[model samples]
Target chain A: MQFPSLEYLIFFPLAVAAWYAAAPRLRWAVLIGAGAAFLALASPTHFAFAFVLSLVNYFAGLALERWAETRKALWVLLATLAFDVGVLGLFKYGNAVLAGFAQLEALFGVAAPPRVLSLVLPLGISYYSFQLIGYLLEVYWGRQPAARHLGHFAATILFFPKLVAGPIERPHHFLAQLAAPKPFDPADVTAGLKLLGWGLFKKCVIADRIAFVIGPIFGHPRDFSGLPLAAAIALYTVQVYCDFSGYTDVALGSARVLGLELAPNFNHPFSARSVTDFWRRWHISLSSWTNDYIYRPLSMVISFHTSWRRVGTVFSILVTFGVLGLWHGATWNFVLFGLLHGAAVSVEALTSRARTRLLGRLPARVADRLNNVVTVVFYSLSCVLFRANSISDALYILGHAFVGIGHAAPIGAKRMFGRQYHILLLGLVFGALVLGRWWTRRRPVAARPTWQRWPVYYAVIAAIVILGLFQVNQFVYVQF
Target chain B: MTPEAILLEVNKVFAEVFGNPSITVGPTTTAKDVPEWDSLNHTALIAAVEKHFQIKFSLREVMRFQNVGDMCALVRAKTGG
Candidate 1:
């Protein structure tokens, strides 16, 4: 069952009960059962693929540990990378590869090959593959010893709360908990429930609500431009943030309820002052994963004590981002989105000294303020590619986003913004999230009296009932 | 090299890598202490430190380093403190 689904709403409590009721040594079995049940319900027919991959990674980790002290381990490491990356490439990008060959044939005026291939990327292939790779790398590097228990490894990988999409749980974080399972704690459950409520509000009251407004525009981006397109850019930035972050909160909250902690995946990313800062703040798990595994290794290899070192470093940035973008989908648009970000980050890096000297001339506070606004606006603009149907559509939208900005607001823009009730719903929820968080930070909500808690809780529940777009829409990140 | 002597050399390495001549690094100083001390510059910083000390760090040794203190400790160990 997916997070926020009615089925999940029923399934969760039963799983919790079964988990706590199980004997201490049998907890792993209980978790695996729960995880398998979840996969069956979520992707009944295709669930075995993920389970198989998990087993493959389990063996890979053991092999790496066996050769941990010898260079022969490098062969195992290479084999693991090849196997994991090969499987992902075959399933996830096989179609795109075929399409490329067909286009090449067409270029020489040969008859394009008839293509009869269909592949549904195994659920969470991109995510689990990375986890497996990370796990193997840690073992090979001697940072983490290989897991002796197969059941613990399997449960960690198949953990239903994070399997579909992920905060990309590390072996250390998830598996360590399995070894020293926590007793059922009421406090953790309460905190987890609170997190779930916040996630629900974000999804139903905000993300899904805005999805409707921007759907038609991105669907046929060339239909209109000017303020409507500009507004779409702004709205979409919000839409994706709410959708992805909303899903992560639910995932983390669910894990917490089970007495495990998942690393946070977001941190008010829009507040970042630069593209590098933005990457660090947004999708923290993915960004940090790439930083450690992709960027660090590449940059280290590329950098030498020569003038070309910087050029090689910048090239790594481009390639890493290109790969990051492609990881979203095997499409040109995602590549562009990643490179756009990579380019910005590269420029920021190359100009660090000049930028520092230039900014030093201005008031430090004002310079910081200006950078924040500039970063958000630039990111919003780049998201045109993230949401657009194709490269041409995104470019068209960008070309005309500000074409008639000084003129009166266009009718389409007016109508989109004039969804008064929806706007009100968005505003209310956004205010509640921001202000409630602020207030809670100053004064903890749980410490407050029952009289106060009941009303606030009722208002939230009523808001969900009244404002929620109740349906079984998958989270945005689930597509990746 | 003593730990204190190693820290002074490491501080010089940071200054050269980040181009912040006034930079100072203490035992407790983590990457968070300097905004410029991000992943992008981290490799260069490591290379510079290794060059200055004529010592090499393995991938594991590099990954395990948490702060300036860890780097200094490794440097002292390698340079026979």
Candidate 2:
């Protein structure tokens, strides 16, 4: 069920209540059972796929650990990864492949592509699959042990809150939490509930509200000039962050309420001062996974083939980002998005020292501010590729974003805001998010009294109640 | 190479790459303690260490090192000093 759905609203509280009512030893059983029921509700047919995927990874990890010889472990690990990738390909990309074949047939005036059994994507396939792969690889490399308990491993993959979307917990961090007994910590629960409310505010009040404008602009990019399109792009940047980060907060909060500590996913990514820093803050789990598995290994190969001081760095960046892009989806747009980021980062890597040298004469704060501006602009431009539906659309937006600068469009402020001042609302919400994060980061918390804290808490609660009463929206990252 | 001499050269490389004047690193020091010691910097640091020590780190070793001490001990083990 969607996070905003009445079904989820009812189900979440009921699940939490039932979970705590059960003995500590049986809490996991309650969660798994409820999570299974929820999965069945979402897509009963695909629930089996998740089960099988988890089983495969669990055994694969065991095999990797048990094998005495490194070569045997390596073989088992590769075989397991292949199987997981095969399952993902079949369910996720099967339709696209069939459609491509059909298009080819029509172009040739030949027979049409056969109608294959279309399978619905199981919830959390992309996330769990990646986690499974990382788990097996880690075990094979002796980074972590194989999880002995099948039930615990199953819960790791199927936990309801993050089952649909995730912060993508590593086996080491997540499994350890799973082994601990559930404690009824009122403070943790309170913090978790507050985090959940804040997440909902981001999704419903900020992201969904912004989507009203962003959706229209993307739909008809040709009609909108530089100003509207740029506005849409800016709004989209916020929308995506809120939607994804909002989902993570809820996921983490839910897990927190259950006495499980999930990792924080987003860290005010927009405030990142470089593409590399952006990756570090945004979708941290995925980025770290890519770094450990893809970039490091690939870099080693590149370094071996050529001297470390020479060709390896550029090659590694391009290849790493290319793989990263492909991982997001099969679309050409994602590929270009990855390449643009890769190129930007490679350029950043190459010139950082020289740039630092040139800027070294400036005051430290001044240099930092200048660096921040340059990085944000660069990162935003790259995001044009990410937000656009197609490569052509991306090119069009970039072309206009650059060329449409001199001439302002004739669109009214009211219309631009959408009906009910959504643009203004989106701006205010986004401004509040950035400003609050900045304020929190800048201010010393110990200096603030409880009197200062209570007002902020009340204001946040009021905002959530206000937003929830009016509307709710699905998080963006659930699709991935 | 003597372990002490190898360490001195490696220390020099670390100081240069990290741009720290008085790093005073011990074997126990780690990336977590160093501001500039992120993934990209880690890779550069490894390369610099390799050049200075004349020893190559396997992928497993590179990935597994927990601290500067681990790296130093590993390097020493490989070099048989």
Candidate 3:
């Protein structure tokens, strides 16, 4: 179920209450049962698929642990990884591959075969599969022991809060939390409520409201040009950040109420001074995962073969990011999005020494501001590729973005905002975001006095009630 | 090689690899402690250390080092100092 829906609102509190009321030793059973019920409420078929995969992975971990340091262990590890990746590939890309094959056949003047199967994507399949794969690999690499309790292992994979759009929990961290007992604390509850409110405001008010403007523009970029198109692109950057990060915040807040800590996903990514810094801050869990599993090993092998470390570093970064891009979707736009980021990062790495020297010549504040602006502009432009329906559509918008910079839009302000109040509301929300960032940079909101904190909390709730779209749009990252 | 001697060599390696002659790592110094010691430089740093110490580290071993102290301990164990 969607996080913002009424059903989830009722279901989550009940689940939490039931969980806390259960005996400490029986909590895992309560959690597992709740997780199953949650998944069933969404999709029973997906629930069944996830259950079977969990069983397979659990056994795989056991087998690997038992056969450690032997060739048998190697085979088990390879087999498990292959099976997990194969399942993911089949479900995620099978249709795209088949359609491509049919198109190729048509290009050669041959009749294509009829469609074989209509596959429905299982919810959270991509996320849970990667978590399980990471667990299995950790066991294989001797980094962590195989989980002895099946219920605990299952709970880690099926934890309802992070199961959908994940901070993709690692076994070393998440499993240990599952094993520990979580006693309720008033402080944690208050913090969780505050965080949840903030997330809701960001999603329902900022993101969804902004979507009203950009939705039409992105849907028909060909009809627009100049400043409006640029504004749409820039607003999209804000919308996506608010949407995804809002989801993460809600997930984290929900977990925190139960005294569980989920990893932080975003770290003020827009403020990053470079593309490399942006990756480090944005989607931290996934970036670190790819870095450890894909980039490091590839770099090791390449560095071994050649003394030209720069070439190896550049190549590894490009390939790793290219894979990251493809992970989003099978579309060529996604591929270009990934390649563009990869190229940017590669360039940053190669020119690090020169950039450092050049920046050293300028004042630190000026250098930081310059880099931040450049990074923000670069990311905003790159996001056009991500948001566009096709590569050609993206190019068309980019080509016409500067066509009439100072000209008044053909569409009037009343049409754009629907009312003058919306313009005021949008301005206020945008100002609050900037002010909130500045305020937090000076002193964390949480560290403030309760009298001060309560006003902020109530204000956020007020914003959600007054300004929120309340349409319960699906979180942006759930599609991946 | 003594622990002191290995630390001296490691200091030199860190300084050269990070391009900062003033870098002097202590036992608890980690990747977070050095601005230049990012992932790209990390592999190069490890390779440089392996070459200097004339020892090979398994990938697992390489991944396990949490700080300069851990690296020193591993070097000592491998070199039988």
Candidate 4:
């Protein structure tokens, strides 16, 4: 169930009650059980598959750690990845492959048949699969110890709040909390609730509201033109950020309520001055994951080979982002989304060096401002690929949005504002996001007192009640 | 190279890239210990290490590193000190 759902709204409190009531030793089991049952609401059959997969990874990690020989551990690690990928491939990408084959057969004028299976995706498979893989790799390499208790290990993989969609908790970061007994902290509970409320405001109010304008245009991009398309793309930027970050807030907050702190998934992404900055801010968990697992590894290949270092960096960026894009879904649009970002990041890296030199030659502030503007525009353009349903549709939106800028049709000022109140609110949200980020940076979340935090909580709730759309669409990232 | 010597160079790189001349190098020191050791800066650190020691690190070696001590050990292994 989506974290913002009314059912989850009620479910969390009751679970919290039972959670704190249980003995410290049994608390992990209670949380895991509640989480597994919660997951069953999406698809009961898939839940079993999830359980089995969790067990496989859990045991594999332990075995990898126990094996004294490096070569033997490497074998176990490779086998585990292959098995996990095989299962993920069958469930997630199997349909796209089948469809691709059918079209190929049609091109050749032959009967191309489709394979049918229930093939329902379990909630958070993409997230948990990645988390599990990270755990295994860490253990195999001796970065983290394998949990002796199977239950604790399972709980780590299936922690309810962040299970389906996640901030992608790491083994070292999260497992220790599960093993230790946590004292009840009223402050943590209050803080977690405030975080939850802020998340709801983001999802229900800002994101959902923006989606109102964005959904229509994206649903049928052809019908709209000029200002509406541009407005829609801009709105989508808010919609996606609020939607995903909103979920992250609730996830992190709920886990906090349980006295388990998850990593922050987003910083102020919209305020980013460059595509590189954007990656730093956006989906921080995933971005950092790719950095560590994919990008760093690839960079090493180049670093070790002096001759291939430059080529390695380029190849790694392309392959890392390509995998990252495809990880979102098995679509050509997603591929382009990955490539576009990759290209932008490469450009940003190259320009940053040039920019440093240019700064010495020109007005630093002006160059910085110009760089920021160019970065925002590049980011918004790349997002067209991220938001569109197909490659052609993305091209259409990009082409028309930029085509004859300020010349095509004068967007009716009144009508535009009337239709997209959130568009106007975008300025406010962006403004608040900037201020809030600055404030948070100045004072860390841990330093804030209970009373000082209440205003932020109340404001978020007020935003939800007054502005939230309340029409739940599947979170964009949930499909992955 | 002794562990101390390797650590001195590691600390020098950390100090230069992160601009925290006071940052101490220890076996347990991690990114959390120094706020500026972020992903982007992480790349800078590895790049700096390669340039400093003239030793290449495989991706596996770089990713598997946990702390300053581990990184020093990896550099030593590669340089055959």
lDDT of each: 0.83, 0.76, 0.85, 0.78
Q: Give the TM-score of candidate 1.
A: 0.92
The residue-level lDDT of candidate 4 at B38 comes to 59
The order by descending lDDT is 3, 1, 4, 2
Q: After superposition, how far is residue A479 of candidate 2 from its true place, in Å?
A: 0.9
In model 4, pairs of residues that clash are A204-A468
DockQ scores for all predicted structures: 0.47, 0.44, 0.48, 0.39
All candidates: interface RMSD: 2.1, 1.8, 1.7, 2.6
**How well is each residue in B41-69 modelled by candidate 2, as lDDT tens digits?**
67778887887768888777776777887
Please provide, for model 2 over A25-105, each residue's C-alpha lDDT reduced to its tens digit, 9 standing for 90 to 100: 666677778778788997786578888888988888888888834788878877888999888888777877777888888
Which of candidates 2 and 4 is the stronger one according to lDDT? 4
Number of the candidate with higher lDDT, 1 or 2: 1
Q: Poorest 10 consecutive residues of model 1 chain B by lDDT?
A: B57-66
Against the true structure, candidate 2 reaches a TM-score of 0.89
Q: Rate residue A206 of model 3 by lDDT.
A: 89
Best by TM-score: 3
Q: What are the models' TM-scores?
A: 0.92, 0.89, 0.94, 0.86
CA-based DockQ, model 1: 0.47
Q: Which docking category, incorrect, acceptable, medium or high, applies to candidate 4?
A: acceptable
- What does the lDDT come to for candidate 1? 0.83
CAPRI band of model 3? acceptable
Q: How would the docking of model 1 be graded?
A: acceptable
Better candidate by DockQ, 2 or 4: 2
